[model samples]
Target chain A: MSTNREIHLASRPQGWPTAENFRLVETEVPTPGAGQIVVRNRFMSVDPYMRGRMNDVKSYVPPFALDAPLDGGAIGEVVASEAEGFKPGDTVLHGLGWREYALLDARAARAVDPSLAPVSAYLSVLGMTGLTAYAGLLDVAEMKPGETVFVSGAAGAVGSMVGQIAKLRGAARVVGSAGSAAKVERLKALGFDAAFDYHDGPVYEQLKAAAPDGVDVYFDNVGSDHLEAAIGAMNLHGRAAICGMIAQYNSTEPPAAPRNLALVIGKRLTLRGFLVGDHGHLREQFVQEMAGWLRDDKISYDETVVEGIENAPQAFLGVLRGENLGKMLVRV
Target chain B: MSTNREIHLASRPQGWPTAENFRLVETEVPTPGAGQIVVRNRFMSVDPYMRGRMNDVKSYVPPFALDAPLDGGAIGEVVASEAEGFKPGDTVLHGLGWREYALLDARAARAVDPSLAPVSAYLSVLGMTGLTAYAGLLDVAEMKPGETVFVSGAAGAVGSMVGQIAKLRGAARVVGSAGSAAKVERLKALGFDAAFDYHDGPVYEQLKAAAPDGVDVYFDNVGSDHLEAAIGAMNLHGRAAICGMIAQYNSTEPPAAPRNLALVIGKRLTLRGFLVGDHGHLREQFVQEMAGWLRDDKISYDETVVEGIENAPQAFLGVLRGENLGKMLVRV
Candidate 1:
């Protein structure tokens, strides 16, 4: 195809983003230059972190430029290559998404085997989200065997993986909180010892009831009350890996919960925030162990895919609204 | 001298403790039992943490029992001893403060030398406060040479030592915040690169102006606005040692600052809370280092002394009110 369609940041949102914040544009696909590869994208990720980039604020990653195509994790087939070690017809992963075509320096893309798993898997369980859960649970929070683990947003991509990893790694009990009853059920199905719908009651009371023995490690996805609940139920010297705060991403006002932060002093707790980009050293070990878990049917994952690049904005909004389960993605 | 005047917890306060919450009691001095010693207390300590113990809440240490004498760091002369290696006239430090006389197991007391330093020094610079500053800065916060350090309550016992230690140990710059201009001046005299009176302006603005680059280590003695300010000024991977929350101790309302805690995720920061009791392993090294600093005139300390056992409760109230320049002590 000589034509390409991509989504751009039309405007910065004040709070919750809408379709008006994004613009879809059509342009001619350009030829690859020296040492560059052009890929026909298949599946692209719509992650919660993209919400932060939509705002005109500095963060770990730069804000998405206005009137420019937003980019993220994408898997596609290389249609042309001017670089060694990459060729046409090879499936590869790169950081140029929300588009039908991606042209980048060959070094930016990594070739993956289609026989090992579906290329869509590269956007979820076997990719950044999976590695995030791995490093955050084991390395960041340092979850030990026989310790109880509590996870917020337990049905979301990273949160689901964290709960399962805790159970698989010999956590005595795993408790999880989710927005809906359906998501809570999904957590239990994923082998969580206990799961609760945060909407049903106060998070502190629910978390207390769910993890009666107190949480030893907390994998935080949704902050605010979930964080306060974790702190209230955390055992002495318990730790928390602050991976994401999806609950507060669109908030124009400061979060009022986690008000019990003073408990950290008396309990001697540690709360550490981390980004997946910083944990690249664990990639090889993570992939090997994750692949083995998948091959042996020791773990499972779900995907909520929105067909067509035109719906990518909706997919991302769905993630923010908790409308999608597991990994939210857009099918190019 | 035959009778001992001790301070007892009269009642628990809902928000802030008052003189009414404490009662002075006079009782006969008891004979020492086997393995025990009776000491006539000279100097006693009144600290921020004691305020927490006044409440009937389960914390790291048990709450003070009603109508029972409060116990803490005290130095005295042994008037009677029944244990081996103990004798009359020997100076000892023990945990039986807020009283004129103390009777305790010999193991609970550590013999100290009066020639080394004033006995009251054991309650401030050469004791728990000193070790707290050492461990919280060097160990808990993992502060390294050439890093920028910011400390709240920077004129208090722990905060003053934290600033001096950071300066002596090669900190690139040290910024601190205090309640008054005098305390701010004291911090500057202690070799802080910059100091601010938190009462002058918003803590965030003052901290931003003081440490223009950013803060790498935050020794948090006062929470609320100070914690919020430090988080705002912290660089990537910055750490905070949460030692105390003197600002929030008496507040009935939840803290409204530190609302930007979500920044921890993007900034990849660590906020760790710790107690001095857990850092006993570092006491030997801390004492040696602190004693050397004192001897070489590398460090200095101040104590706000409130005379008489009858005024011990008022002294503790003064500490909570930030009336102390360094350590607040009760002289018996």
Candidate 2:
């Protein structure tokens, strides 16, 4: 039997995670039982939301058990299958724990068509991140043609998709905020009408100067300051879709919203916090549309990939710090 | 020509407005020319939104001109008319300035039918306050039958209407939060399934304990802390209609929000801010429905009438401070 490397929690971080918080262990690979297949992980994702899981707080998803193997979105190759609809040497994506080799139930894995897109692409562009952007912007934000759209963290995996999708849906202007100059440039090349480097100044001023007419739809990836800024810059009857708050993720203290919330009354703004998982009906439609965009080169994606399972915790910490560009990934 | 007594803005306030900010001015009442009419004022209104207009800031409506008479909702009798549709002695409601007498263009005012509801009801239940409650709850909150609803400031004019209307629509249960014990008692009598004083304890704990199944809809008349508490107590796929943020109206400093915004991602919550002016499409339908409710005694309204125009500033400041139990009005 082959030995596989696994990454387990060393200890939970108080705020930002560190490499020391993860412990690498080696375990013997067991034979696949009935209706099970062995998956050899190729690439894993490290997202900003993983920071919340490091704490023992009650949330939508349950907290990760202490000293247990960490799991996230992963793409792998099936070396062995003990059930139908699977065979030896097939690539798949599943919610298996972070390990070089994993024995997963055959029913839990779906065959990945390599000819359709890159295996790593599934972890970013054609995966949960893409679906989140589409559902939150279209279904929750209720974006209409000819309206101005603003996105926070515009260079991230989800923001990039949101800007492009807005353009495809005929948005009059698409503005986005990024942490670095390079990301802002990338946002422009990806069809954003305007992009601002948030580090240049208080995001409120930069956002106001960028969209003078006021934003019609605000896709919030960073909350608190961003939300307050959007409230100030929104036109009458604006809609705000709150998807993430990466800005407040590492704060031990409570977040403070600006007093401008009073604008909510006069402007008739709609601020909705939504999750993509809530809209199950849109899955097939999203997959079809996103696949077409990928095939036709209408959509482009960026990734900051790190190699080896030992680096997952550090990469996660980096994501929480906004150090990585686009979607943070680990190539095992 | 007849003389009219008008209340003009003398200065703006720092925190709570005082009587010194307003000055009663004497002016000649002009005769009706073309479509104009002279209205003998009966009941005048002072609302929290006027606080925003007092500041020389850009908003939905332009700031009140410095050293000029303040205009707001008013009910009066048309003592003279020069327009088609309006006749002498016809009672009307319009955006008339705070004064003993108002000279207005006839088309700017609407005739009030006291046979359907009382003339004061035009400034309260059949006016903007009632429309605000209707549009916020039905159009913005999107209430479902048998769903639980939670409303803040339930004894206030807007909140009172919201709770009663939700009950009329077959709400499973409606819980309300008010500032005083008397207001809480009034809310329970106003058809609230449960009522609590916010001064009792932490609203988060109170709301969570009272709404174990979680509130499906929240009609937010008070913002800041109340919003944070509601966020914690919301059920999966909840909707919040942000009508007004009375809690933060007088705070010089911004208030802090709980670090629970990320809960929106898990629960698929939608928090939308709105103003009644944008929902003019529902005006006639709301008037018809609310008038019927009032006639059948299915609806009840309360008013705190401050006697005379000289007390308008004090009355407005009182409304902002939540000192008025229901719709605060001035008898001219």
Candidate 3:
């Protein structure tokens, strides 16, 4: 039997998660069940939403169990298969991440064509991250052509795609906010009409400077001040899709910037929160459009890869701290 | 010549408004020009939205001019008409209140039948207030049958109607919060499944006790703590119609509650703000349905009438203080 290494939640964090909260455990690889496959993960995604699962509270998805491997999006090669179709060395995408080996039912894994794109792309732009940006911007916020759009966390995986999609859809102006100057420049390179670094000044002032005419659609990934700034700059009947709130995921105290929420009534704004799981209806359309964009060289994505499985916790914490320029992943 | 007594904005309020902010002026009632009519105002509405107009800041409606008559919903009889169809003794509804008489273009006034229902009914159950509740609860929130609904400011005009309509529409449970114990009791009588006085305890605690299963729709009339409470008690994919924020209308400081708005992301909640003006399309259908309810005695309405144009300011102030049981009107 081969030895497998997996990351486990040693304990829940008080506010910000630290390396001490996670443990790397060694286990013996088991034989595959009748309809299961054991995969050797190549690249595993570390996303913002995984932070929510670290808590014990009940939410849309159950909390990640303590002292158990935390599972997410992973791309791997099937090392052993008990299923009919899947064979050894076939590239597959599954929901069992944060480990060297994933033992899941064949139904839970989808075979991917590694020849068309890098196998790691299956965990980033061509998968749930890209789908989230596409669905949130078009279906959730209902962004109309020639309208102005504002997206926070503009350098992240979903945010970068949101900005690019808005431009490709004929948005008059797309404003983006990022944590660094380099990311702001990257946003501009991604075809954003205006981009700002939220660290320079107040988000409202920076956003106002970036988008003077006001924002018609806001794709919210970094909540708190970003949400407040978007609300302040929103045109009448503006819509916002609340995708993620990475800014306050580790905060112990409540945010104070959205104090002017009363303005929503006068502006007649709509703020809708959505999950990609409920948006399965848009997946087919999103995949087609996103794939076309990729083939035509109209879209580009960046990835920040960590070397070892033992660094998965650091990768996740780096995502929370806005250290990654785009999708952060752990390579096993 | 006849003298017209009208209320004028003396000065903008710093926080909470007072009688000093309004001045009663006597002016000669002018003769009607072509395509115009002079109306003898019978009853004028004093509403919460009027408070917003008193401020100097720009909003959906422009701020009231200093030392000028403040206008709102008024029911009156046409005393003189230069327009072809309108004749004397014809009752009309117009947007020129806080006055004993009004002279306006005929197109600005709608002819209303007084014999079918009391003319004051046009300002309450049969008018904009009723339509706000109808459109907000149904169209904006998209509330369905068997859903649990929670409404704040349940004793107020719009709030009262929202509770009744939800019950009539086959809601599984209806909860309401009011300012006074008597108002809470009235909500129960009005067919609310659970009613609580917001003063009794923290709104979240009270709401949780009222609807342990959680709320599907929230008609937010009070905002601030009430909005926070609704968000806390909301189930997955819950919707909130932000009709008013009376709780913070007079506050110089920002509201403290609803700090947990980040919860909207995890819970997949939708918070929408709307003005009654945009819902003109639903008016005819709403009036027909609301009128039928009234004729069948399926609905009841209450009003707190303050006599004389001089007391109109006081009546408007009373509305802000939650002093009225339902609609607060000034009989001129």
Candidate 4:
């Protein structure tokens, strides 16, 4: 047996979570039980949605228990196995994260080919993040061939993939809004027809300038002012896919509602919210299509990786502050 | 030729409109030209959507032209005809209101049989209002059987139809929010399983009590606090058909947005705005179903009729103030 280092939720956060809210703990790396396998985690994900799980409220996913090791999407190699069709040195994806090693049922881990793409991609563009973008744009927003699409948080994991998917699907115009000038430039480099820094001016004005004709689909990730801006810039019969609302996740006070929602009536708009977990049935179709796009060099992805499981909390905080350019992950 | 009395948009109102904004004028009732018909108006409809047309801003429907006769749903007897498929004394429905006479293209009028139902019924239960409820609930909201439905503006034209239709379609519970205690009782009399007077308590609390298990569908008409309350009480995968936002139509300032919109994400909710004009394709099906429902004694309707063409503006104001029991109409 060997000792493993893992991060635990030491306390509930009041506002913005800090390192003090997390604690690095040591535990014995357990042997695989019947029908179980042991995985040595290579990369663990720290997403914006995790912020919602930290709060003590009923949501789509349950809240993280106090003093328990946090769990999420992770990519790792099989160190040991006791089930059929399992072997050592196999790269796999599982839902046990923030720890160096995990003991999980063999059925819970999915095998991934390391030669096809880097192991980190399974925690990002080829994994949950990629599927979120795919299902949200194609199914939730119902993107058509000639329509224009606008995405908020355009440089982040899901947002970046959304813009690319929309463009590849024959969008007439693809626009994006990011927090910084560099991220805006990065979005343009990623094939977005127009990109704007929301801080440059009011979001609605910047969006109007970027999408002069009006947007047919809006991929909303930031919520609040971004959502309001999207509502204003959307054309008649426009659709919005509400993926996340990271802006108000940590606020102690209730966020002010978008003031222009009434425009929805005259514009005949549709806004729908979604969770990636509810769409697991799309995995096979998503993998087949996304893998082909990657091989064809039609899509690109980025990652901001932090070293060591001890730094996982900081990586999470960085994501909340919009410091990461793409997928934020922790290398254990 | 005879002198005809017609109402003109005298001036635009800044806040709530008054009788002074409308001017009754006298003009010669012109004879029908080629492919046209001259109709002596009987009953004209006054509705909430007309308030949006009073504004100069662009919307689904064009704003009423300044100092012109306002157009709306009206039923009249054809006094003269110069086109095929029509004759004198034919009762027809046309887009001409706040007037004692109308000269319009023959194609714009549809003949109705008074032997089937009253002329006013063609403007209310069997007209646009009925289709609005039918399509908004079945098509836009995608309501399912065994679901709970909550409708705002329960005593108004479209909302009353929504409640009755949901009940007849096998809704587990039909809840409604109205302005007066009498209106609440009337909603129950109309087959609403639960009804409350929003003026007696906070809308959210009242909705919580009315639907303790949460609502599956919300048909929004009154759009301020009632919309907010619906969002608060919606269950997972809930749907909202936003037909109108009468509460904010006359406000000088923008109404506050629904505060709990973030719940949409975790709940996987869908909110869609629709106009009855875009849904004219459903008219044939809706008329077939609603006519049968009415004839079979499965549905009932009410009309708050004000006398004369001069009282049209007051009746419209009364609708805005929730003074009508169901459909508000002008007997010209």
* TM-scores, one per candidate: 0.99, 0.96, 0.99, 0.97
| CAPRI verdict (incorrect, acceptable, medium, high) for model 4 | medium
Query: Per-residue lDDT tens digits of candidate 1, residues B80-142?
Result: 999999899999999999888899999999999999899999889999989999999999999
What share of the reference contacts survives in each candidate?
A: 0.84, 0.81, 0.78, 0.83
How well does model 2 score by local distance difference test? Answer: 0.86
Give the alpha carbon lDDT tens digit for every residue of A41-138 in model 1. 99999999889988878888899999999999999999999999999999999999989999999999999999999889988999999999999999
Considering summed lDDT, which 10 consecutive residues are worst modelled in model 1 chain B? B51-60
Report the lDDT tens digits of candidate 3 across residue range A178-255: 999999999999999999998899999999998999999999998888998899999999999999988888888877
Chain A TM-score per model, please list them.
0.99, 0.96, 0.98, 0.98
TM-score, candidate number 2: 0.96
Candidate 4 lDDT by residue in tens digits, A64-118? 9999999999999999999887899999899999999999999999998999889
For residues A1-332, write the lDDT of model 2, one tens digit per residue: 48888888889887666788889988887568999999889998888877788889888888887888888889888888887888878989988747888888888887889777888888888888898899989999999999999999889989999999999988999999988998899999999999999889988899989998889999999987888898899998899898999987878777776447778778877778877678778978999999998788898888988888877777777777777777888898
In model 1, the runs with Cα more than 4 Å from the true position are: none
Q: Which residue pairs come into collision in candidate 1?
A: none
- Runs off by more than 4 Å, candidate 2: none
